[model samples]
Target: MKPEIFIQENIITIGQLLKKIGLIQTGGGAKFYLEKNKVLINNKKPEGRNSKVKNGDLLTINSNIYIVKKEQDI
Candidate 1:
């Protein structure tokens, strides 16, 4: 159930990204999901909500995982 949307950045805030992309049902949903230890970075377990996601990294939530390729040019 991985998502196709990619996050591009040298260090992306998980909470901000989640809200920006409408992944969680709500803003609080992101914190709740993260506190439940349901989020992983680069296939490794992540516990910090403010964790930064860099390029070529991987992120997983629930059954969905996303790989951070090149940063999206804004």
Candidate 2:
């Protein structure tokens, strides 16, 4: 199943993504979680908390998948 993520901007950071997924509550928590767990962005581990994710990007956290999509202005 493909999960959609709608955003108003061109991209979102890794830390923001974690929060959006409800994985972490705070920005500092995101940092700590990323350091402890393995998060794959488009099949590769993220370089840092600020890694940019854009449309069509694939994010896998703990084996679950999330797909980034453009927000439809309907």
What are the per-residue Cα lDDT tens digits for candidate 1 across 1-74? Answer: 44554665567777766776786666567777687756788777665656777776677777777876665687
The total number of steric clashes, by the backbone 3 Å criterion, in model 2 comes to: 0
lDDT of 1 at 58: 72
| Cα shift from native, residue 9, model 1 (Å) | 3.3
TM-score of each: 0.67, 0.84
Candidate 2 lDDT, tens digit per residue, 1-74?
87777666678898987887688998778778888987888999888899888989987877678888868676
lDDT of 2 at 43: 94
* Candidate no. 1 TM-score: 0.67
